[model samples]
Target: MTTDHIGDVTKAFIDYVDHNALHAVAPENVLIEAFLNATAAEAAEVLAHLEDDDIERHLPRVIVHLIRRLAAAHKNPTPDAVAYEAQNPNLGIANQPSHLRIVKYITDVYTSQIKGDLWSVAERVAADAYTRRVGEDCERLAQIALTNVTAAELEHHIKTNVERWRDHGKRLRRITNHDNAPTNLKAVA
Candidate 1:
């Protein structure tokens, strides 16, 4: 809620803290550092509010108190509250057309060598492209960073296919999340 002075306002700042919690160090030096940068009086004001009981509750209280002090220090971000997008389009737009060209060219090459089913043709094209992209070190770990993930390709194949089972969402939709997940079983023998 907005107030004339920040010290009069109340808010739950758990969202920011929770989002960054996985990467944050215990006692939250990252958050403390942000608080310290605001001012000494602000630091004392915030650190005084940190609850030291159950850490699940305590850490978030500390984070919220720290964030409030930091917010009070600055001019508000987006004081005008207008949204904006990037002025320039990214190179990925250019890259997508080139990707389609590569797929078309490779598919043609494989088709000429032997007439086959569309599925086999696509698989061969992908394998050929992979081999051509990485000559010798196909399975090497260091090369994986340079490799492109075919995130769309498999989904595209399943979506466009004639088989009813191809729609994995409908075929495999869970009644309850992870209720169907397999657990490790040890033999009693």
Candidate 2:
């Protein structure tokens, strides 16, 4: 996964590769002189290992990898740091939200076709796992970010509903795990 040019870490390059893959264009033609600042020969050499079909089949995953590299570069600026981060597919906090968005895009634009095809079981599984991992991370991140917010909302709910609870002793007791007025009222106090 060595990048031939630092431009490989750019969003523009990722988008170009994605678009070309979707349109069934050869990767060799991806870096033509007028495009993305690379010569056609350079692009061909960089992508020599990739057949057009390979690009189409693996483009989503490749995009994710490039994004990871881009994020790493943005954060650390060192090639070693970027390469190390790219090797790990797990999302990091600095770029989690954006990465999640890209993963969603990949699933919508690429995985649907791969999963729908009966011959792509392995690819479907990989895509499903990647999306599932991203989802789990996002859920955990949201919970961490929302803990105080939820508690504040709950406190507001209790304040607004205190009178109704007092009117219905049974409900208040049920909620507070107590039969006495003092214990039940302690919640709002």
Candidate 3:
């Protein structure tokens, strides 16, 4: 959530790379400036670091490490974390749509519900829980969209929630216009 954590993550990445035998072609090796600046023996240093397997087994390890970091990084961010400075975790959190936000909020709670938090096992349980939540939420939102809010109901709700009332007005108003929307707005439920 904090920019300070980037250095730790960078160190983590470097440590993982240093320990594992990924056949990495360092960025310096790609450019002509690197070739021209370096001595002939510099290439030897590069060769020494690279893992020389025909299969390049370490490549998969690098991918797994990336995924692991991502999973680790996906720790739930608070609303205020992104307010001052825009960064990762923040970007990841900010970009999620409201529909997904509803599902994620519910699923995240379900995941963290039992005995504090277990990241791995929680994900599995949350997956099952999320599926059901999404389905139910989708059906409910669909039903809500179809149903018209009575004028008195809208007025009463607007006192508490003007923005939400406006959104409902927009949704209903669209369906009310025969030229704009083909489907009828009225619903029994």
Candidate 4:
């Protein structure tokens, strides 16, 4: 996607958070900073605006989904792909064992079957096998390719995100007075 598209998506995400009051639920600055410095405050602001229940249930899933999507988009072959190339005769020779080179070889195999663009049926099948065998290992590695994040980083992320949410809860209680609301107002109001 273009930079403009990414920016637009980011803006829309922020707007969604604001509209939902996620910031009131989960101030996300620290967690956001952990992901990307530019989106830190904006992400926190968005998280702060969500409902507590919604934030608890959905935020982690959203983050994981985003990570997975990014990972898939930038995914290249892994060491397994190199091994596959080494074993396969029709794939020819590969002097180096680099991930990109292996991925290219896989892509060539994929493209050959389609008779069109460089797509990889073999790679897809292998990916499926990897998913079954490694149980998200390839996907995790793929996500790592998209960002410099690590499992240890994610542990920090969990802690920060939780703290932000808790802080938002405290702030929300201090900011709102339920008893002072007009009696005539509906519960949904």
Candidate 5:
């Protein structure tokens, strides 16, 4: 896909994340700027090489990692700054316990909805549900610009996921019914 398309998709994914209530520790705008700044044509090319199955299986991890990095950036302005300083040891080693807890929470919530074999339609449905919720929350955050939240970050997250699903096309639709099916009629007795 072209860079413009990729950017559009990224935006949609971020919007989806904001629509959902899932909280990211990082400021939304900063996170989004970071993602946009880090991602390039090469990143999209790398994503393109991924099979649908792989994308489906690993998207959650990608999202979690992205959120973690964003959160870290928020807590630690400098590269050497420690994240979650409250957990830092006397020796100055930052305690990873809080980070781990947050990561675990994100994984738990994401996987709970997207669990099961990739081939299963239920898994796709679950993944859609998960993404949809995230999008909704992101949108909400964007609208309100809640304290400690950044609209841009939430928008970026939603855009990314939306793009992924759009790229998968048939694979995603196969697991979903976007249009309402026609109802069957009963014969008059």
Candidate 6:
């Protein structure tokens, strides 16, 4: 599906956090750092080791593992971390795994699908509309994770996204002829 707008909005949200949040100043923040350093190529390299069918099923787990290892290695340097650092010296994490690169790759893949681009227009609109709402919440979570926030608070924050998603559909319907979008979109009118 054509998700170019989706990627554009997603990048906007990330840029907002990177530019405005406390994490922007704190390079030591592992979550943000890993995200900033992650690339599609790294994710592709990890997938090269996996069977095609397993890629989607195991991608999230691989990302989590890479992040956790990143944090672990940063907290306590090890030989494996050194080896990984050699490969991804910019990451400043121990045992830099190619799996780490897959994090951002998830969004890139969304924008690459051509067959269903028309169907995804509403999604892109929704994303563009709600970028700041989502970005602020994410920034808040990242900031609080470094200090204080209850599990219940965290759960509430996460649950709010579901409602926002619903709202996106509603807004798209109100704002545009999303349901009847042309089957084949062209850049020029």
RMSD of each: 27.2, 24.8, 24.9, 23.4, 21.3, 20.3
Predict model 2's lDDT versus the native.
Answer: 0.37
Clashes of each: 0, 0, 0, 16, 41, 4
> What's the C-alpha lDDT at position 27 in model 4?
25
TM-score of each: 0.16, 0.17, 0.18, 0.19, 0.20, 0.26
lDDT by candidate, in order shown: 0.32, 0.37, 0.33, 0.36, 0.40, 0.42
Indicate the TM-score of model 6.
0.26
Best by TM-score, which number? 6
Alpha carbon lDDT at 164, candidate 3: 39
53-107 per-residue lDDT for model 1 (tens digits): 2122333333333234334454221211101111123322222233333334223
Better of 3 and 4 by TM-score: 4
Clashes of 6: 4
Model 2 clash tally, residue pairs: 0
Off by over 4 Å in 2: 1-18, 22-119, 122-130, 133-138, 141-146, 149-189
Give the per-residue lDDT of model 5 (tens digit) for 83-140: 2332333422222345555445444343333322212323233355456645665686
Candidate 3 residue-wise lDDT, 131-180, digit = tens: 44445545765565566966676455435454534443443343334231
Q: How would you encode candidate 4's per-residue C-alpha lDDT over 87-152 as one tens digit per residue?
A: 444422223344454444334333322231111211222233333434344455456556878778
Q: Candidates 1 and 4: which is better by TM-score? A: 4
For residue 188, what is the lDDT in candidate 4?
A: 75
